[model samples]
Target: MQIKPKFGVDQLLFGMKQTDVKSIYGNPNKQFKDEDQNVIYVYNQQKMRLTFYEDEDFRLGYIIASDPELTLFNNTILGRKATEVQKELEQHSFKTWEKEDFDLAENHFNEDHWLILQSEYDQIVKVEIGAIIKNQDEFDWKFGAK
Candidate 1:
């Protein structure tokens, strides 16, 4: 019950609005508007998926997860053993990368934040967190850039 790995929780960072993400994760069992209209929010009991745009006043911006009880910044959870969470995200300095035919693994704490891991026989089913938007056509209409 300690899932505070980042990408909006303790001060709700990335652009912030939507009533400060509904005062921190409330009322979103589901919501929609995509096709470039943005404004998506799903919570599947905290498995998470948030994306808001309406030209930034809708804020939030994106935070998708596959939740294995979701944890990241060093504690690295989400079903573990993707080489032990890529050696605890390279002992906390991050900078990892591996695609391995889509077994996937990534960690780029720059170019506007990142962390994704998806493995199969080696555990870690899925986990994704991306927040980049420096206006590449509004981040390709809210994350077709991913």
Candidate 2:
């Protein structure tokens, strides 16, 4: 299925209600609330996970997709060679950063969103798209001022 690129997956983006997500992707395989009260929806068959912050009107805040069928705006497919994906992203003028094991590409259309490609050797094993929560101090405590 060709997924239309958006802030999130397809029409699912920041400020979209949970019901909207369900309407498009159907009910998640599993759902739960974290200790922080954020709702988590896992679609194992689709190889995707969506997270919504409880404080943010229960809107979609994060999306992780490892499905090979999913493709970015530039038609970059998940699980492709990292170099190939990098080239596709570069061709679209998206700024990229090379990490130790993976690479990160910032969405040129939306600064708050990012694409995380987990790589092994020279191949991308996973892909994640998510919004950057502004109040890192309150929401993301894992990485503190680093």
**Which tens-of-lDDT digit does each residue in 4-120 have in candidate 1?**
333443334566666666787777888999998989888786777777777766777567667555666636466666766666666656654645553345332323245556666
Clashing pairs in 2: none
Q: Please list the residue runs of candidate 1 whose C-alpha ends up more than 4 Å from where it truly belongs after superposition.
A: 1-40, 56-60, 69-77, 81-83, 87-113, 116-128, 134-138, 141-146
lDDT of 2 by residue, 2-97 (tens): 333335665566556679778878999999999999999998877888888898667776777777777776475765776666666665665655
**Candidate of highest lDDT:** 2
How far does residue 35 in candidate 2 sit from its true spot (Å)? Answer: 3.9
